[model samples]
Target: MPVCFNPLDLLMKNITPRSQIKRGENHSTRDVLLRLFLLLGIFFLLFPLRTVVAAESSGSDQQLIRMSEILRNKEKALQEKELLLREKEKRLAVLQQELQQKEKDIELLRQRAEKVLAEFQALKDEDLSRLVAVFSAMKPVAAAPLLEKLDLPYAVEVILRMQPRKAAKLLSAVNAERAAAISRSITSAKAAVE
Candidate 1:
């Protein structure tokens, strides 16, 4: 192998003194060179400490970035939950409005039905009154036979609407079995009303 010359070894070699009187000058130069090498060695040793500090700072920065990403994801999830809650509230409000409208419609229908029922009752009463008047004009013996031919409930309603004296006279004329059945129906109807 070729011999390699070392620059550091060449710099450390003793210089030739020109004369005995220059010996002290060479010793002073060697001391100065030794101090310079020590300073350069210290600088190189401290360079690795600076690199270690830089690496630790970079690691802290990476940790901060990761924490920030986590916070952002949590914030996004919270926003989504709030949006869902708002949508549910809107749907609940709409359903409540529909329920209220249905209730109003049902109430109106119930009132209309009551009005129609009242009108029908008034017409029935007028008819019953007319029938009673017709029967009152005829003899009880003749009217009783016709009344007995009617359904028991209808016969009882007609008899109950007549004058007490007329109703008693008609009842006396009707067949015993038919009159008893009519009386029973009238009694049941009165009890239900009470």
Candidate 2:
């Protein structure tokens, strides 16, 4: 076999352990410098992004607070409306009760008025009956002359209440027009009764 001499292998064999250690220390110092620069670049790139994200989060929080306030105001308004509705209902109930009481009072007044009217009518009837009796006891000639001086309606009422024969006698003594009016009034009064 022929011997082939290699220069790289011979140099490696001649290198000292102290020189290898010095080379390794230099490579370690470069690695530390590279790692420091990479960390500074990452911090610079991410800082603005972090600031923008924080600003957006603050804006969202303000919007959420405003929405909450609006909801609270709406709830307060609804509660006020409910209270107003209840008050109106109470007022309506009171008004209805007052109206019912007024109706009852009106009915009572009407009943009292009817009773008073009936009592007044009874007194008028009694007075008319007594007047008729007084005129009937008198002589027809005397009664007729007195009746002629009275108002037509009063004379007619007195004549109509007398006995038929006495009424006829008294009427015959009066003027023809007066007797006719009395007869007509009596006929109408009888018709009203029927």
Candidate 3:
């Protein structure tokens, strides 16, 4: 294998005087060359140190870039969350509006139902009064058989609406079982009212 000489060594060799070329010959020129080599060796060593420092700086820059990228990703996630929250808020607002509208509609329906119920109750009361007048004109014996054929509740209502003396005569004319049941229903209804 061919031996390779360092370029610095070749330069030193060329600068030496012909008289000092002999091996082990000490001279001022040799000392000067040694000093030059030491200084150049120090410079070469420091050059590698500078390269190491530059590499470290570049590594820090890469870390900064990575950190910045992470921050950007987090910011993007936050923005997406904010958008989702806004969408949810919009949905909630719409739902509230719908709920309010439904409540208004329910209120209107309830009012209408109340009005219809009131009209129906008035009509029922009028019909009951007319029925009472018809029954009151009849003799107790004649009304009693017809009242017995009616539904229990209707018969009881008609009898209760008549004068006390007429209602008593009618009750006496009715079948004992039906009269007793009607009396029980009337008693229970009065008890509930009290």
- Per-model RMSD to reference: 10.1, 14.0, 8.8
lDDT of 2 by residue, 127-193 (tens): 8788788788888878777878878788877887788888888898888888888889888989999
TM-score against truth, every candidate? 0.69, 0.64, 0.77
Best by TM-score: 3
The prediction achieving the highest lDDT against the true structure is 3
List the candidate 3 regions with Cα displacement exceeding 4 Å: 1-39
Residue 97 local lDDT, model 2 = 100
Counted clashes in each candidate structure: 0, 0, 0
Runs of candidate 1 with Cα error greater than 4 angstroms are 1-47, 191-194
| Evaluation by TM-score, superior candidate among 1 and 2 | 1
When 2 and 3 are scored with lDDT, the better candidate is: 3
| Candidate 2 accuracy as TM-score | 0.64
Question: Alpha-carbon error at 78 in model 3, in Å?
Answer: 0.6
